[model samples]
Target: MGVICYTSGTTGAKPKGAMGSQKYLVVAGEIWCAVDNWSPEDDYLSYLSPAWATEWVLGLSSGLRSGTTLCFPEKPETVQSDIREIGPKVVFYSARMWESLNSTIHAKIADTLAPFRLMFNSSLKIGYRVIDARFQKKPVPLSWRALYKLADRLVFRYVRDRIGLSNIKWAYTAGASISPDILRFFHAIGVNLKQIYGLTEALMNAVHRDGDIKPESCGVALPGNEFRISENGELLVKPPACFSGYYKDPEATKKQFDKDGWIKTGDAAHITPDNHLVVLGRMKELIDLGDGNKFSPEFIETRLRFSPYIKDVMTFGEAVRPFVCAIVVIDYENVGKWAEDNRLNYTTFADLSQKPEVSKLILKEVERINSVLPDWSKIRRYVLMHKEFDPDEAELTRTRKLRRAFMVKKYKDLIDGIYSDAGEVMVEAAVTYRDGRKGVFKTAIKIRDVGGA
Candidate 1:
């Protein structure tokens, strides 16, 4: 019997899980075996939630069937220590994880490294490698490439060493779209990262090849990949090594499977001039900005999240407004580093975000992004969330998706406070303290002036 895992359904949408038979595992095993060129001596780790379909296959079965020693972190905060201890030959993470790591790295250091290869992506973007070092900003007078090689060796090598990514041969990323800055940083450094597109249903459909890695496209359909575009621009796929069907939800299975046996992926895609596939946005999540202009939340979110301080973001516009608005979450550790680097004093995340200087920084960033976007698609107004998104809080699913519907309903007062004229907005929030006591705080959030992007 095949196991099935659904899309978390956090977007107020229906949940549909991928179903596959024993053959799903069988073919996935074959693809996994050859893709990374795994060996009996490899060590791999599973840091993703077991409930996610990608983890169920790649993080679970791929490691077991291939003889890679699979390890899990004892605690979430200990992921770095675990990676250093295990020194996995292969690594995989979601776009969020990559974003978090990249944010942490960039906020702290912008250096270059020696030519040791480290793969660095989930699935959202790909074809990057981080070397064991980082380079400093210096004007290379001549063929300074030689000097950069020296600086990478002497200075940047410590970066990968600190993160225990010295020996990583391959890294994979997926789930959501990765920020362009984050994607460029890794490849520019020397990590062998590349894009791979797959769903729980089709499993692994498109993969970047050794020579055909394109930064903008997901890559060509794999060796046995078959695909077509529907009249509405949806991508329909069939792959030999992909998962076949849902385990038991025959209704979902029937809904996803076409009469011709192609798996109907609700995501839209287009074949580029170079033959690579560029995924647009989900068919379901399209937002109309009330001006007959459509905005892809994923697209807008990707741009907003390009700000290193933004760790998580969700925008709402749909049928309500002429422009988009957003809920922003800051990555505390990184923002904390920013605070320290600039000697900006703040007691907590709320304190830091509410500071006029910090608020201006975010405003400047938002405006920078909005300037290029059409007015209807731009994020006109935003609210900095005082409370961080956490899985235990139910604001996020186990896979770390923003439960937009849940959050919109649960934090209705907070969301409403953004549009209110009170410059300072207040809401009562219940949270579990570190001491395990439950308490409620009437938190106050200060709205930031939205600038052009």
Candidate 2:
């Protein structure tokens, strides 16, 4: 029997169901089995919900087609422990989960004893160089290779085992773009981490091939998939596993394809000289600053979120403003630990954020990020939010994507303050809590100028 899978509803629109034919599922599975080098002997971890297209293709279809044994975690909370025990050969975790794992690993490393910490830090440096060389397809020097092997055995081997990735020969991150730092760290530690780019509409698009991986590009297109850049810079995909028309929505489906029958991906991307796909960002999400400087806020936001102290970010300055600024949400656990380590007393997230020390810490991070960004795209100033953006309040979508229009409308005053000469702004925000309780969150948010371009 056929099955129906609904969209994640992260586009701030009604979820549309896509019907999958049994034949189509088998074909999709066969494609993944071939591309990923899956075999009957391979053990696959079934984690992501089958509602997601990636899981449907990679976990369900491929598992069936390849005759691979599939294992499921006992419960949602026990996935990590179960992974450690099973040590599956293949994994397809979401980008967000990879970032969380990276953060957790770093936090654990930071808390280690001094001698072990020294070994871990040194081994990581050696490992990064080795991984970078391998990714570039350059031969590792004999001396460095020998040292890397030692580092891998002493530190990285244990780290990978602890993260339940020691046996992962084909680990993948998809669903959304991930930070390169996370990808690099995993590869450095010998996890063979790679990225796959696809959409719910296009089942399997592109993935990094072994020995040809790049942190910047999402690797070459699959054998049956073709990608072309449209005149307006949107990525167009033609794949064998294309979805049927949106359920009961022929008009929407008609608009999603061109006269030539290629599916419009709505993502801006460029193909590298090596035939790798380098996705920019959503074409509709580009911020055009009247004078011709246009950039994607997601690019800067992703880089900013690489910091452990920062949790969520929403950047502003499109048509109305000349420069960029951001609203930041701090990571409560990490920042709270920082506060406690420094003997700074803070009862709440709001109080901790307002502390001069905390502001300075975030300012340093912003400045560090600015050092590598182009002048027009750099965040000139930013305000730390006392409370995180909530999906219940429509600030973020169910999948944690920012609803730009909603954010612009809801935080107009805060946006105004960022452009103004105000050092700080008092905002009384009406928040909708998770329990459906409404309350006013009044806090004076500091707007620190990051001086240099």
Candidate 3:
């Protein structure tokens, strides 16, 4: 019997189902097993939602092909300890989850005592140099390599165990672009973090191999997959494992393919000389200012999200506006820790975000990001959002991608204040609980200027 799978519906639109034949599933499973070098003795974790194609294929179908043992956590909260216990041979996580774990680790590390903190930072520095050399395809210097070995024994090994990545022979992150900093950090700590580029329709297109890892690119295309860039810079793929079509949606199915048989991926990308694919955000999401300058909000957001305190960011710019602005969602746990250490009392996310000290802390992060960006692309102003964007409220997709247009419409008033001369603005917003109850939240959201810009 043929199988049907519904996408996560992360395109700020309605969900659609794709149909796949049994033959296709078998071929895909075999291909995945071969590419990852999966063996019968391998242990795998099934943690992500099975409704997601990546999880279903890799955790179920692929495991079936290799006769691998699979484990599932008791609950989502127990996943970390469960992972430590099982020590899976192969692991996959979406970029968001990896970033969240990165933030949590750094937040906790910052709380450590002086001697321990010094040792951790010093070891990481040595590890970075070794990994950097390896990424450049150059030999690691004898001294640094020796130092790294000692550091690994003393620091990185423990760090990896704590993070439940000590035994991960192959660690893959996909679904969305990951911060390069996060990838580098994992690599520095001796984790073989790799990026995968693929879609629900195509299953997988590329993955970073062991020796040829590139943190910036999503790695080279998989075997039996031909990828090319369109005239408008959209990534197109022809993978053997591609779905037949969108189930009961002919128009949508037809729109996915170009004049030729290649599937239009709707993502903008460029291939490096080494054949690694560097995805440059979605084509339709590019922002252009009136001054003949254009930038990818996703690019900027990725960099801003590297900050330990920034849980989420939604950047905005238009042909009419002179510069860009952002709505930032602070990492509650990390920021709350800061508040506690400073003896700042706060009852809620809304209250913490409105505090002048909190605004100042976020401004410093914005300035750090601004220092590396072009003048036109720098965020001149920003407001810490009172609440995190929720999928239930239609502010984000189920996969946690920002619905830019929807968010713009929902927070038009706040965007206006960002461009206005006002230093702060009071606003009332309605929040929806998971139970479907609604309540009004009112707060004076401060708009902070970056570097007097």
Q: Which candidate's lDDT is highest?
A: 3
The ten-residue window of minimal lDDT in model 2 covers 429-438
Candidate with better TM-score, 2 vs 3: 3
Candidate 1 residue-wise lDDT at 269? 81
Query: lDDT tens digits, residues 47-157, model 3?
Result: 888777787678888889989888898997888899999888788888888888889888988898989889999999998999999998999879998999999999889
Ranking, TM-score, top scorer first: 3, 2, 1
What's the TM-score of each model vs. the native? 0.83, 0.94, 0.95
Writing each residue's lDDT as its tens digit, candidate 1 over 1-453 gives: 577667766665666666667777667767766766666687777888776777766766777778777878889888889888877767778877777777766654522232322312111122122211222222334434554455456544555666666677777777766665655566554455666788877777776564556665677876567888888888999888555555556777788777888888888788887678888778777776666777778777776777778878888776764457777887777777777768898765666666776777777777877877777777777777776888797788766767766877887766666656657677666655546777667777776657443
Candidate 1's TM-score reads 0.83
Residue-by-residue lDDT tens digits, candidate 2, 1-453 = 366777766555777887667766877887776777788888899988887878888888888888888999999899889999999988888876777677677777877899999999999899899998988899999999999999988998899889888887889988667777778888888888889998877787888999898998788988789989999999999998677778889888788899999999888999988899998888877889777999788777777777878888888787778899999988877888888878999867677878999989889878988888888889988999978888888777555677777787888988899899999999875655546777777879888888876
Model 2: clashing residue pairs?
A: none
| Stronger candidate by lDDT (2 vs 3) | 3
Task: Give the Cα lDDT of each candidate.
Answer: 0.68, 0.83, 0.85
